[model samples]
Target chain A: MRLRIIKAYFLKEMIELIRTKMIMMPYLMPLLIVILFGYGIKMQVTGVRTLILDNDNSQISRKMILKFEHSKYFTTTVKNMSEKDALREIKKANIDAIIIIPSSFEKNSLKGIKTEIGVFIDASFPSRSTTISNYIQGVVMDLANDFNINSSGMININTRNLFNQALRDEEMIVPGLIGMVLLISPAILTALIIAKEKEEGTIFNFYSSPVSKGEFLVAKLSAIFFLVSIAIFVIFLVASYLFDLPFRGSFFLFWLASEFYVFTALGFGLLVSIIASSQIVAIIVTLMLTIIPAFMYSGMIMPISSMSGDAFITAHIYPVMYYNHIIYDTFLIGQGFNSPTNISYLLLLFGYGIVLFLLGLLFLKKEIK
Target chain B: MKIFITILLKELISFFRSFGLVILVIYFFTAEVYVAANGMEIEAKNVAVGVVDKSAGGMSKKILSNLHSPEFQTPKFYKSQKELSDAIYNKNIMVGMIFDEQFEKDYYKKLNPTINILIDSTTASQSLMAIGYIQNILMKFNNLELPVALKMHKLFNQNADTGLFMGVSELLSVITLLTTILTAIAFVKEKESGTWDIMLLMPVNPKIIILAKSLSQIIIIMIGVVLSVGLILFQSLDVPINGNLLHFFILTFFYVATTAGIGLFIAAVSKNIMQISQLSIVIMMPIIFLSGAWTPIYAMHPLLQYLSALSPLSYYIEGCESIFFRGTSFVDLLPYFGGVLILGVILYWYGFRKIGKLF
Candidate 1:
């Protein structure tokens, strides 16, 4: 009786998702996010923008101007421009910012007068604006030190992005891209499976058919499991070969962890689809259920522990915690976290995945009507 | 006016009928407020740090002891930069402090000895705070180095920059995006349930129906805003609004209108909630990523820098910072609001055409 009932629901779900346009259409979002982010994500701050309004006209001011002109971060867009022109340049955003050495800056410096060398920045673009401000602050401080009269001590920062020795964007983004795709694995399948059945009017047929519910559930979920595995394998190849993500760990271990993570994603996606009234609701609920918490708390970029207690707890509830661990170990670090603390995180996620799959089973049962 | 009021009431009833709607509201509030408090804000308070001192000398000891003590969140120590960097990558550590040898010698002779500080700039807000703390410590070092003749004028509030000041702005942006997205979800839900057709067959024009739906959603969105402001006030999560509260609300009004219009557009173009939701993610990704939430916008590609200008949330965040944190007046904010107004009008116009086709 139980097997027949489960199979009845399983076939019912599979038919509905296959027919639903709304549910099926979003298979594109994960793919698009992957392609775009693969190209976009980077850490190294480039295009350090600086505008020039040099009024000194003297050899010293001109020479100092040349030093500002050719730096990795600083790019001088304009010169010999009036204050109006400079302000106009700011409004037009002709530059990220402007560096104005007053007409008598050289004279004042030579005379040991504290003449202000005004560096006007376009604060509209906050990050670049802030970057422009910071780099200029450093360069101007260096110039002041060269004078030795009013020197502000320069502080140098050296960065070593630990696991990622190279600190390449590809390594950083490709893993995130893969996680993002896998995160959607179960969700897309779950979303479409039931909706297609509902749309195709095959849900009634499943109920009439003699197949046991257990066998039916097995078939419906097996199809999803197979598709999800393919998606994972595809992402792995892309991350490994196309994006050239660093793979120092055993591929088998990575594959093992990923299989476990995919099961969790599928279970959650199934649960989401079960609750939804239509394909649209299924997708939105699933995305929110998976993406928001994962993106925020899964310790992918932001440390979940840094957040408040409740938020921290919520992060663990999503599959991102385990899947992200798998990604980090496989892609960047080359091995799983050797410490028990790291291993515990993976175990905790595995436990949560089981719970989520159970929830999917229960919710699917409830939604059979 | 009476007809509009009736339609508005009707729409409100429908929105309330769906428990899903209220659940979404809760998600928006919880996620935006709580997440923003921890991650989105520019304010970093009581930052936890780890400090390592290999140099066993007196000056190094002083710096280490200072960092070791609870004054600066009692920084942790690792054997080397390698271990510390690994901690950062694994999210086990937030900041790393290393004091090189000859620390005092370089101070007196002006050798400009570098005090290396490693921070995870992924959470840009916290990283900035760590950077500020380092600055404060170093500034103290500088004061001891020089004879201390000149008193430098503090032109700006150095600590008040983005951390606490911009936290509210970031929260506002997040809340606004989620609200508009939720409202869009309702429209798509209507389509999926076949209620959209029923609305279309009514005596009212489809445009009026859309307006009524949007207007009802506006009320719901404002509830979220009120909740956020109330919580911020209670929690004191951000620096108090320095500029003007009334102006801040006024700015929120325009922002909501623009987002609502955009949501309406999305609802009309997309067939169902799932499609709209997916598309919404696509639209919101750049807005969130390039908005300087996690990483600094200046650090992004040039194309993204210019593209960020098109994001209404960007203007809203800067404006909120100006009013609430920076204490800038209405005239100072005209430029930001002007940009928002222009974008809102253009998006509204474009969305209107799209909605017409979809409806």
Candidate 2:
């Protein structure tokens, strides 16, 4: 009898889901976010606009200037500007850094006297400034080494990047984005689905009828779970194919981990719906609980271990934090099913899903209290 | 005027009374500031590394010791390549290195023995920085006698506190998003509750209603901005607001006006709260991404870099940075401020038309 009721409820919910564009949103939203973030977020700082005010038109000075111009890291614009104009440009943020070559540059180099190349960087954005300084140092160092000045005890280091060989920021971000995409729509969709019944007074239909609360709850979970799974699958394929993200681990393991994550997110949404009286309230609560914490506390941008005190504890409790670790480990580092770190976090997420689901069932009432 | 006053007062009361929205607003502002202040660091510091030193030569020892400190940790010594790779797999270390046995012998013989390094580049930016640091150490060891020097001056932020800059930008982004979402939801909620139709049927001008609703939202959002900027940013974080406070506030008002206008337009088109929420996310994602808050605007592709100008959040971020970090006066920020004002007028004009037709 309960099975029949559950089946009836599921069919009704599915029909409603199909009719409304709301049902299609979970899939579309992730696709949109993936494309947007894929194109947008870049960590490698390039094309630093540099102005070189060379007073020394000497061949040596011109060579150094050419190196900066030739390099992909900098967009060098050679200007014969005064110190005042250079300072004004830096203040105005028209130029990121200024390379001033003094008239004595070539003379000092020829006489074996030490010459200082003045580099003034706009430090308003500290990260960019630091990168600019590093790039400048590299350029200058290459020039110094080209001089073939003999030095003692020269040891060369071969830096080889493991896993992400190219050190592509996109590789790291794409995996993290899978977690972000899943967290964004599913939780809110589930919360709104349940809260809509309550707000529109449709939930009372089950109270007046013989249909069990368990049937209703199961029906709702299955409907959302079904919709969100398709979205996750599409996102996974897009991320792997389009972004060239290597799926080093087993596909089944990745799918299993995603299912566990989706369940936990849905459980969180169900809990929010039970507490929230309106759709607006449910959305705000779900978003505040999910998006903010997922983005901030999860080891997406900042690694969980790097975070101290409350943030570490906060990361520990959130299910996304566990999945974030699992996804990154499995995808990038190629951790297998038996991998201890991957196994433990994935298990923790499963446990989180069960607990939240049980709590959601407990809070979901037959009558609007 | 009386109708505007009554509508504004009613909206204000309802806003304060919505405990859920209030808590969310408080949480978003406080958590954003707290996370921004604490966790955001660009420089890779204290990364754990595994070192396999077969040579144990003097040069290798000097290089290993130099690796220990702010950029990297005291690297755990390993016996073989397998153990180092295992450590990386377990994430016990972010990087692994194996020094060739003839490292010192080759150095003396001018046969440059390579110190083979394995870096887990999942944290790409930090790993890149770590490579730079390692290269720097090697270069210094190479050029012990050669005095090729370059003078570097970090102009504005002498200490180069990246967290401070991130915190300020994050605070502004949150304020813009929160205000826009809240204002739009406020209008959409009334429509969903059927109160909007009654107000339209009553003897009230649509213009007065629009003016009142926007005014209330702006005022409430300003309060949040003041709290976040004054108390959290200025005092708690000790982030410098180098420009004129009065000018900053005025510029902020114009920017808020632009966002509020966008919100009203979204609300006017949306039939229910659900649609409002969906539309808001769709609209907000690109704006937030392109706003130069998380990623630098200059880093984006040139076309996107140009298109980012359309997002009011972009202008605000630029204007805020100029005022806070560069200590640029009001005159210097005229372009950004003017952009906000122009955008604000156009959006509000369209919004007023759409909402008036609905009435």
Candidate 3:
């Protein structure tokens, strides 16, 4: 609790981090995550490779094929291939789907006799296939409308996307990536630094010194918390400038929430360091706890509402999910601390920080066992 | 040869002795795989919807009735559009609909009555799919007879089960992560424990030592893969093996070796276990991202599509999928094998020399 003792420990931790060149990690990790996930992780399926077998060889069939070609969802190549060959192409993983316009397709369409356009989709990846089928359905509907098929009823549905108008995947992914990167890098760094002290027997310096366990732990956490807070700011700028992420909510509110979340993450690292006997074990344990949950249950790849049973409960228990909500709400929904629900989420983050810090302190021994 | 076996056995023994790491490996291969496969729902399920039925008419009620369980939760009726909008903002409901008073009357008069559907698009996949579902319901209400019917045959995965795909994909990602970290730590641990000098002084080729250590970790990871595939993918999730299981294992072997090369390079440069974890995340994440494990390759930007070719995981994932789902023949599997081998040899050689010189 002494200020002088805390300062000495903090300065020592900082010097060690600088000597190991670990200072670059806070900046480097976020940039890497943003660039890789921002540009790389796309949920919207586009450019599905499609092969068309147009047996009708008529203008109507050609026009139908053109519709598929023009649509952003598909890249169509028309060829004189048989059904068997097209199936072979799909099986070889060469193409994603096949469109077959039979020889009688044009004849039947012109006569108002209902015909069928056969679609063979490679459903190896089920989600992609579902999206492909939806796109194909849309294209077919557009074609039907053009032919004056009157598919539209007396009732029309006008759909509007509220938060992300264009439904850009990055809008969802970048903000979530910020939460993910911040959690993993700081946690791993803090865990490894403490575990290294134990492994190298340097922890005896604190064990034999006048520094209380609380002061030592707090000083270590503060050093990482300080550096990572700066890193978070840099990441926010990167997100806003490089990714063009709009910040619609209160900046002050978001900043306060971030500090709490960072503290919780660092405390989790502290707990892992105390439990692990070696630096390698600490890294592995930290990753095992943080990475999978953050990716799977934090609503990063899958929506939390879509989860059921144990998964839903798991999502609620993790601090990452709460932080994920804050990120999305602030970045996309523009809802800040005004919403009572958002305030609750912020408070939960603070609670998790306090709980994790107490847990780490409780486990940290002043004398080596 | 004797030196290699001795070091290999020593490495394996030490690995087994670490009870904490052993338990973690088991948990990752078993419980982690199980939760991911069973938990993640890619297709839209239980989409919470709210509606303001001002019309209170037959057609509006009929449309509301169409929104049913599994795909959607039964629609909750709200008094006004503002209330529904608030519900959406609060994320209480993903989709909200407001039916004007003229809705049913206009429909009867053959005047197209528009229903305003507001969607929260933060969870893009769910919202997009939900939109499609709503449109279908409205289209059915339109009841317009079309000229042509589009018949879709979903091949490979007839039921569109997300679990089967997710389980296998998670297994692959776990493989990449473990192989890289395990191999890197094997080398870095020796340095951290002040045993690197002793390892160098031993009467053995540095090449044999590095090969033995890295291979030991890969062997451990391969066993973890087997457990995941057997217990989680096959037994629990019922993921089918359409092609020869041997082919899947072979492709995995090449992949593990390739990633182990990256781990060796990481160990060569990193001074501690912390650097190993940091460098692994920096290096491994991009490979996973570009591999199209989470995202479909076709959906990525053209430049990224081109860049995916350089990632060894892209080939491994494609090969495994083709083997499992498509039952592709060995002849057609050559390109995947070639990609893995070519990449593996270059990486393994570079890392082998990098660490060998230090010796």
Candidate 4:
């Protein structure tokens, strides 16, 4: 844990990571990030296939029809048809829902009486259908308000959601992939660098030659981190220019954040690599720790908040959670990045990176012994 | 039988010695339990519901009241359409509603009255239920007098039980797959560790070693299986395990044998654990992804669906649902048994051949 020991270890770890293909990942990440973010979002909110059965064919009903068909929410298979026909269409999945305007609608309106428009929604995908329902209701009521249905009551709200726009699947996955790719690449490199030495009986060279662990690790991580940063920069440039994803924040901040993230991942990966006698244990242990957590709890398909207390608590223990928070926050949030927490997370990431880097160095001594 | 038993015992003894193997099991099962209980879910409880009432009339009050009712308590007091839209786009709210100014007039008039609901469809599902609940209340309030019937149609059945749906499929996949893969690796990793030859050097025949390993793990596996079942049950997941408990053991035994065959096959062929582990992952990922554990396999494209059908998990789940959810007899589950046994035999035969080549 001495300063020299730490620095020497950092150098060694970095050299090991660099010698392995871990150094190439940072550059590869942005391309992977873009592909993962740009292409993965299946946001098909259209072609919702709506059929309208206009019973009234009246002015008000026609207005309702106009609102639905033109508002971009409904791709119409609408017909002035029988209830039986509508039912058949519904069964065929030809329409998400049917809007029924009764025969008495216009008549009732003329008499200053109650008239109703019916809407059926397919709420199987509660997320999408609910939004669709609300959108339908809003368009109808806007026109109705113009018609002076002064008593329309708080109008029925319907909304339909097509696809997610807040964050794409690629965006969610790319950041996690950053952690995942680095996990294997750097850790394997770090382990093999050391393990290779051990396996071939070269540790005596390092010990006998006065090549301190601290210097070795620092040089190793720094080289890998620098190479990774270059990789990330290229990916970001391509992602922004080619993929049309908005790079809303400072490139420097992303670098700072990922550097911290990479360091921590690389550190733990290195530490586990050192604990291992062979390259095999190192790879399995690192992957087992990194891959599953990266996939499951990173707010991709499942929300971390929804995870039960224990799993939720456990998810935080992995560096993946922090990395995910930062990646999403920086990439998607687009909010000004001058906050104390953001700054702190960045620092904590770096701090852990350094600490774990040291831990790997310290642990390497024991493994070697 | 004795040879198989010998192989199994040798594998089990090797497993306890491998720190990585034991830890992986603990991590996998424990995490699965935690994920089933907490991580794997659809959450919408605190989702903001934005409402805009242009009417400012009597019905607005009623709609607001209804939204605020104790039985249907949801926060529904959003101000403007812009605000609501912004909230939704920003992922702040799950749903939004806009009642036109004439809402009061339409309800007061005996005319076709309508209300617009602008809903944030993200972070929520089966939203028509919420919309329908409101419409039903209004319909009841009006004594079913509205000319249009508020029919609620569900798009996809998100209402399908997550625990039952996920647990039953996953139980089959992870348990069968993990056990088989581990059993396969058991003897081989020890051989790599140089422990197998040491055991072979002792009084024990290779056959007895297999038996001891299989028998040794029987208790631990049963314990692991029970613990997993307990973890799931503890969360009140409420997935039915209606088949005979004894039948579970019987099915598991055959399934395990088949998986063990697969494991042995992997171990016998591979020079090292990494090779087999990588192979296991490659084999397992598609099976897990396609077998409808996390996402519906039927939901996948046709090609992927066919691939899913190829996985043993499809049979396992089909048989499991029959036994667990539908409560069918073991005879009814013969297809699953047959599939497992066939797969096992093929893998074991290949494994034995590979082992013969290596030794």
> Which candidate tops DockQ?
3
lDDT of 1 by residue, B200-277 (tens): 777877677666767788787777777767676335564455567888788887778778777877877787655676
lDDT of 4 at A23: 49
Output the worst ten-in-a-row residue range by lDDT, candidate 2 chain B: B139-148
lDDT of 2 by residue, A92-131 (tens): 6678899999888888887888887898998888877888
Give the per-residue lDDT of model 4 (tens digit) for B72-111.
Answer: 3365566777767665544345456677876777776655
Candidate with maximal TM-score: 3
Rank order (by lDDT, best first): 3, 2, 1, 4
- In model 2, pairs of residues that clash are none
Give candidate 3 misplaced runs (Cα > 4 Å).
Answer: A151-153, B296-303
By TM-score rank, best first, the candidates go: 3, 2, 1, 4
Off by over 4 Å in 2: A304-310, B57-61, B107-111
Candidate 3 lDDT for residue A252: 82
Error of 3 at B29 (Å): 2.4
Q: Go through the candidates in order and give the clash count of each.
A: 39, 0, 1, 111
Better candidate number, 1 or 4, judged by TM-score: 1
- Tens-place lDDT per residue, model 1, A281-304, is 576577666666656566554555
Task: Give the total clashing residue pairs for model 2.
Answer: 0
lDDT by candidate, in order shown: 0.62, 0.81, 0.87, 0.58
* Docking quality category of candidate 2 according to DockQ thresholds: medium
Model 4 per-residue lDDT tens digits across residues A1-369: 256665666666666556553444444433543453344333235446678887778887787777777866567755867876665544333356777777888888667676666776644333445555666665654664565433423334344552224434344445455545655555554554565566557667776766566666665566566666566666556655665555555566777777677677778767776767766566666666665677666544444433445766877676666655555555655432654445666777788788887777776672236
